[model samples]
Target: MRKTTYLLPALVVAIVVVLSSIFVVDEREKALVLQFGQIKAVKEEPGLAFKIPLIQEVVRYDDRILSLDTQTIEVTPSDDRRLVVDAFARYRIADVVQFRQAVGVGGIRVAEDRLSGILNAQIREVLGADQVTSDRILSKDRGELMIRIRDSARVQARSLGLDVVDVRLKQTNLPQRNLEATFDRMKAEREREAADEIARGNEAAQRVRALADRTVVETLSVADRDANVIRGEADAERNRIFADAYGADPEFFAFYRSLQAYETSLKGDNSTMVMTPDSQFFEYFKNELSTNGSVTLPDPVARAEAPDAPAPDAPEAPEMPEPFNLTPVDPAPVDPAPESPEAVDPTPEAVDPAPAPEAPEADTPPADN
Candidate 1:
């Protein structure tokens, strides 16, 4: 009975000790054997691991890839342009022994904090290079720039036993104040360009208008010159026609001119003229009277010169003969002379005159004369 009790308690104690010494390491995790706060063994592969009971303990960590999201940080580029950058990293605990030594009990949390700082530093360094600009950071080359950032971060992360797989810029943006200022600058530039375009258009329009005006003036000048030439030719032709008509008949032309003068002189019914009867204007009337055998009146000058001539009652004067036409006519006998001149009355009523002759027979001789 005593042997059974001792052997049973010994077996129970052995089982407890064995159970405490063994620990499980999953495929997704790595295990660290710690002896009184000191690292004794590292179990990287999956399955069961052993440790000294009551004197040692096992610490497990994730072996799979991890992600870390960094806080938004402000960085300035080579051009002195400030930007807000947000980034993320893909990493893993590459050296678990080194990770335990460096991080101690803080585990993945401490590792993440240190790696995040490293990534932020490298981001600022690569993005702030002299050749890098804000435009390039936001351009298609961003991927290549991120690769550089990752490589730089990896170099610094080696001390922390972290394997930096990749680093990527998640978001990039300008500050709110800078964005507003840029918008204002762009708007002003566009307005200036628009004004310049309008001015150029007006200048071209004015040039075209001036050219059109010049063309119109030139065309009008040419037309007026041609019209004047045509008018001069017409006037010359009219004068030539008048000259030819006058050369054809000089007498007819004179007669026509006289008639035109008469028309001009006697234009109205109230017109009056005071001219002598013996004037050349009566030449046509005298010729008609002579042709019809009518006696012509003596000129006023001849009557005035014959004041001492014989009177009509005196018989001493020879009888006058009739004027000839185609042949001569005989003279009539004269009475005995009364030498002294007969007493004559100077007044118009004293003499008994012969009967007035008709207009057609005024030139014929009287039988009693």
Candidate 2:
């Protein structure tokens, strides 16, 4: 009974010791065996690992890729333009032992902090180069700049047992103090371009308008000249026709002109005219009587020199000849009379014994059609 009690207790103590010495490492993690704060073994593979109980302890670290977000930082480029930048990084523990030694009890937390500082420093150095500008930082070429930051940060991260896989700028922006000013400048530039375009457009339009006006003036001038030429030709043709008609029959032309005049003057029922009966305008009417009989003409100069009113009640002049008949009549043969002395001289022999002048004849009315 005594042996059983002693063996059972010893077995229990050994089992406890064995169980405490065994440690497990997952596929996603790496294990570190440390003896009094000094690394003794590294378990990089997933499996059961042994350690001295109460003397050696195992620390597990994630072997997967990690992410780190850096704080926003302000950097000034070579042109003295200030910018705010945010960045992020992808990294992994390349040397777990070195990581443990470097971070000590703080582990991944402390390592990340140190890595962030290194990344920030590298970012500032590369971006603040003499040839670097804010435009380059914000452009597609920014990818190259990020590569440079990663390469640079990778070198510095080695000391903390970190491998920087990639570095990227998350945001690049103008500082708040300069944002409004930058926007104002851009707006002004656009407005100036717009004004220039408008001015050019107006100038082109004015040129087109002027060209159109000049063309219109030229066209009108040509049209007017053609119209004047046509009118001149027409007038010449009309004059030629008039000349031909006049040359063919001057008397008939005169008659036609008189008829046209009569038509024009008597176009309306209310037409009125005042003229002496012996005026040339009535030559046709007077000549109608001459067609049947010869007309007698008096010498104006002799009549004016000799004609004077006879004394009243002097010897009655011989009975005056009767007036000619107005209607047409057949000719009748008659005896020839002796020539009168007054017929040649167109004056009486004695003006003082001349008879009173016969009453004037009444005016004849125009013939009806």
Candidate 3:
């Protein structure tokens, strides 16, 4: 019973000592000592520490870097590119006293709030510069732009005793109005290009088809002309052969042609001919009739009695005109003796030559006047 009593008091003292002087610092935390609500010292190492039982107290704070996920915000670039930026930052508390003095018990909240405002300002300042335009900022450059924003925010956020390791975005997007306008314009442009290309193809196809048709027409026309030329040459050769045969015997040709004409024009029932019974041409048909047993002829001597062979086809005589009755007139008597040129006067008139003064006759001699 005495040993049990001694063990109980020792256990009570050990529990008091364990509870009063022991301090633990985790890997992610720092232990701070406070005297009468005033910070006396800080233990940054991760291990157990000692503190006065009733005079000093230990407080723990997070020493490792922590993350603060800020709210998403809409931002406009310099060249009218709109996007939503969800930003987050990594920071650590470097000055615990200042953090507590500024935010009381909820000091991390104050730092996060202040960091959000400052990070937003830095993002706006960097992205709103002249270089960050719609054309310059692309999906490939998003990571690089984030790095620059984080670096710039680091310098500005370091003054608050909290290191800003990084600032990141969760998402980025265009505004509704800008997205709709871009989609509509792209659709219209593609449709117009397709229409123009199709029209050009159609025009080319038509031109090619028309050219082929023209070529076909020209080829057929040339072939037709050549065919006609060949036909004319064949006809000329046939005519030449016939002329050679016919020039050998013109009379036989005429006789054969007459027979052909008779067969064509006179063999029908409606044919007629004006011919005598004993005519020369009648012999052809007369002999033909006898060959067909349609007619018989007596001896040539008895047949000579029939008009004596039609008088051997009498020769035709030309008609003579009546003679006119006209009497011939005698020329006038001419003087035998020659007259001298002085006997004639200038005019061509008949003048009688006067005999030399002759003896008187029954009539008195003409006076020489």
Candidate 4:
């Protein structure tokens, strides 16, 4: 009985000592001792910690930084633009007592919900308003709007006994439905610009073609005028040369012209020309017809005997040299005895002057009267 009593007392002392001594706490967690629903101690340091065994309860909570990510929500601005917003936050518990009171072990999810609401409210208020729409933030100025939003979210997240260290926004973009409209508008603008360029090119081409036509016309006209002037000058020079030749020898010119005409007109035709026997133009034909024909000039005396008048039956010859005319000599009187210086005998025949024996009367008997 004495052995049992000593053992019970010793065991009771050992239990008391164990309950009053330390409990281990990790760096990642905070330990709280609770007695009768009241906080008796809190251990924020690492290593061993003491607590009452049955009278006090130890509750450890994560003291490390944590993250809360919210679901995307449709945010509408005053301009009626709606977009999905995704946001996240990082926090750690600072006041373990307050954390326990505000957000119990299972109530952290609820607390996160409350924090999300606060973050959303602040984001909306700073970045947007019900009556006004703006991406600009006033507290952090216009350029640093995103920074201010994150900072403001962190500050506002503390109300739920949670500290927010970082807040981030991942993506913000137009929805699929708006993309096609934007592309269509861009295409329309490009088409307009292309059309304008084409129109200008056509205008330039028209101007060039017009200029070419005008140049062609002017060049052709100038060439035609030059040709006409040159032709006229050539014709005038030809006429002058011909006139000078004719003026120099009209008769010769006429002969040449007649020969040219005969060459041109009589060569191919089958007509024969006839003329009188003694025609000047018949000389060639007559000479050709006679076997012994010879071309010779007429005797001068004969030409004088027959002054060749233009015969109506004769074919005319072009102007040719005229034949010379000659006179017929009187028959010389037998030279009557050499005309013996006889002019002295001018008396009728001579026989000394008078008493010429007249042919006696014998011869007288005039024949029967």
Clashing pairs in 1: none
What is each predicted model's overall lDDT from 0 to 1? 0.74, 0.77, 0.67, 0.61
Candidate 2 lDDT by residue in tens digits, 1-369: 999999999999999999999989999989999999888999998889899999999888999999999999999999899999999999999899989889999988899899999999999999999899998888798999999999999998998888999998999999999999999999999999999999999999999999999999999999999999997887677677766755554444455555444544454435455555445664444322244576533332333344463322322234434442223222243332223222221112211232446999999998998
**Which residue runs of candidate 1 sit more than 4 Å off their true CA positions?**
187-369
Tens digit of per-residue lDDT, candidate 4, span 1-369: 999999999999998788566689999999889888788888999998887677888888888888888777666556655555677777787788887787666656777778888777766665566444433322234435556667787676555567778777665444567657757987999999999999999999999999999999999999999999997887677666656745554434333443343343333325344444454332323222223565543332332233343312323435534452223233323322111111222111121222224564554455665
lDDT of 3 by residue, 115-182 (tens): 88888888777777777875555557777788888888887776776778777877676777788887
Q: Which digits, one per residue and each the tens of the lDDT, describe model 1 over residues 1-369? A: 999989999999999999999989999988889888888899999998899999999998888999999989989999998999999999998988888889888999999999989999999999998889999999998999999999999988888888999998999998988989878988999999999999999999999999999999999999999999997787667556545644553334334444344444444435556555444543322332345677464332332334344423312323434431222122233332221123222221232333444678466676794
Which residue segments of model 2 deviate by more than 4 Å? Answer: 1-19, 238-369
TM-score of each: 0.52, 0.63, 0.53, 0.46
Clashes of 4: 4
Give the best candidate by TM-score.
Answer: 2
Residue 276 CA error for candidate 1 (Å)? 51
Cα error, candidate 1, residue 72 (Å): 1.4
